[model samples]
Target: MGRGWRGAAARRTCNPRGPCCRVAGDARRPSRPRLSRSLSRRLTVPETLPSVPWRGPRHGRRVGTDPRRGPQRRRFVTLAALLALTVSALSASAPFDLASSGSDVAVEVPDPAPVATPEPEPEVEAPLVVPAATPVRVLIPAIGVDAPIEVYTDAMVAAADGWIDPTTHDVVSWWQGGGTPSSDPDNTVYLYGHVSRLEAVFNYLHSVVPGTEVTVVTEAGEIVYVVQEVLEPVGKEALPDDPRINAQVPGRLVLIGCYREPDQGRRRTTHNIVVIAHQVDSAK
Candidate 1:
């Protein structure tokens, strides 16, 4: 027989002794078959194989090895690449100012300009006013006396102290040193006349009652005064020192004249009469 016949007979032969018995008539088992070159190459593990962390069983699948994990793994890699590119682009576009952040460098910010404040207006003082009017005429309606007035200056005569000796009885005399007829309440205008002289301007002045209105005309205009008082007769000797006859007190108008007593006769004048009035109205 050929080798094939021998192999067939070997397979068919049985040992009379059990499987562990080595009997004299037993057929030897055929030698183990050897793999072919191609098959061996396919089964052999490569020495240059890439290293991989060992995972058990199902977890041992490499990235993209499973059909479900293939697309997911590719998307993850793509997203990572895009995120890196975005970060790099942002960093390049907006660079930090490293030089200004240094410890030795100083940054300056300008102060705001001050607001313009307007200055306050200056205070202005009023001008001082000096009155310039002088009495030109006198009128006492209650006594029916109206006469022109003349400013009698004491400096006109070397020996005269503003006292006038009337040459004519038709005119009245005003002292230049006395106050002018004005709106000033503290000032008093003085007028002097003689009742003892013939046809005197103040001949009927003693007859003027307390309620009479007196008008004194000046270059400015007429000033009206209501009689406030008819003073008692003052002796002629005490006339110079009498405060009633002077312009020192608060009076608008004052009329002074020699007083004649009915018992003392008309020609003999021992005392003087004073009439005081206050300004009521004026027309300028």
Candidate 2:
């Protein structure tokens, strides 16, 4: 519609450095310089943009000389330059580096104060052992029994089914293969006496209870044992198999006896009773 104006499209860019716009080419005042023919064909840019007065470098950074500020060139920096500045600031305030200061820094590593390692504890010696003497007689005041204890080896016991012979009605049979009353194989000395309802020794063994005191004489002196428990009656077959009867006993005295009723009223041989006793002290 005008003599000097040109229009090829609705929207276009005049140039990157200038005001690119749309729909209003003539909206620009004629007081400013005009756009070039080539740029006008490419973009619809305003002929004049708003201007700002430019100041020089801001805090050591460059500013544009375009006499304006709105389109000032942005400032940027590289990693090397930023890192150099950070290191310089840190070096001014940080403690001095010993490595950089070298030998004159006298970085003395103290000789670790002599660790007083305690002298190794001296080795100890073992106590000398004296074998216990053979046991002799046994005395149980609770049951009025003070019988002679005769040596009865396992062989002798086998002949009597691990019991005191019926003929020896008043004596106690000490199991000989077992260790002495004070020595190890658990110090278990098995002793059993004949029990007749009428006259045999240990006839009252079943009546004994816990805490009964029994004393035995050994050639070494006298050893006293206190009854710890009175176990329930065990059958003759099971009695032979008991761990305590077969030399597997712990360090305690095991007294065994049978219940014999006179004349088969309730059968003469009933289940055997065992009285377990533990030695409390010794008298030399």
Model 1, which residues run further than 4 Å from truth?
1-131, 156-158, 263-268
**Residues 195-270, model 2: lDDT tens digits:** 7656888889989999999988877677778998897878877876776556555558889888554464546576
* Count of clashes in candidate 2: 3
Report, for every candidate in turn, its global Cα lDDT versus the true structure: 0.74, 0.73
lDDT of 1 at 65: 68
- Backbone clashes in model 2, listed as residue pairs: 12-43, 12-44, 13-43
Error of 2 at 164 (Å): 4.6
Provide TM-scores for the models: 0.49, 0.49
For model 2, the superposed segments whose C-alpha errors exceed 4 Å read: 1-131, 161-167, 183-185, 244-250, 261-266
Best by lDDT: 1
The positional error of residue 12 in candidate 1, measured at the CA in angstroms, is 99
Candidate 2 local Cα displacement, residue 246, angstroms? 4.3
Q: Per-residue alpha-carbon lDDT of model 1 for 1-284, expressed as tens digits?
A: 69976566555444667575443324565555799999999999988989899876775677656798777888999999999897676555544443444433345759999999999889865422324478888888777888899877767433454345555678788877677876553577778887864577888888888779998888767778889889899887887788666647644788888887766654677788888888776655
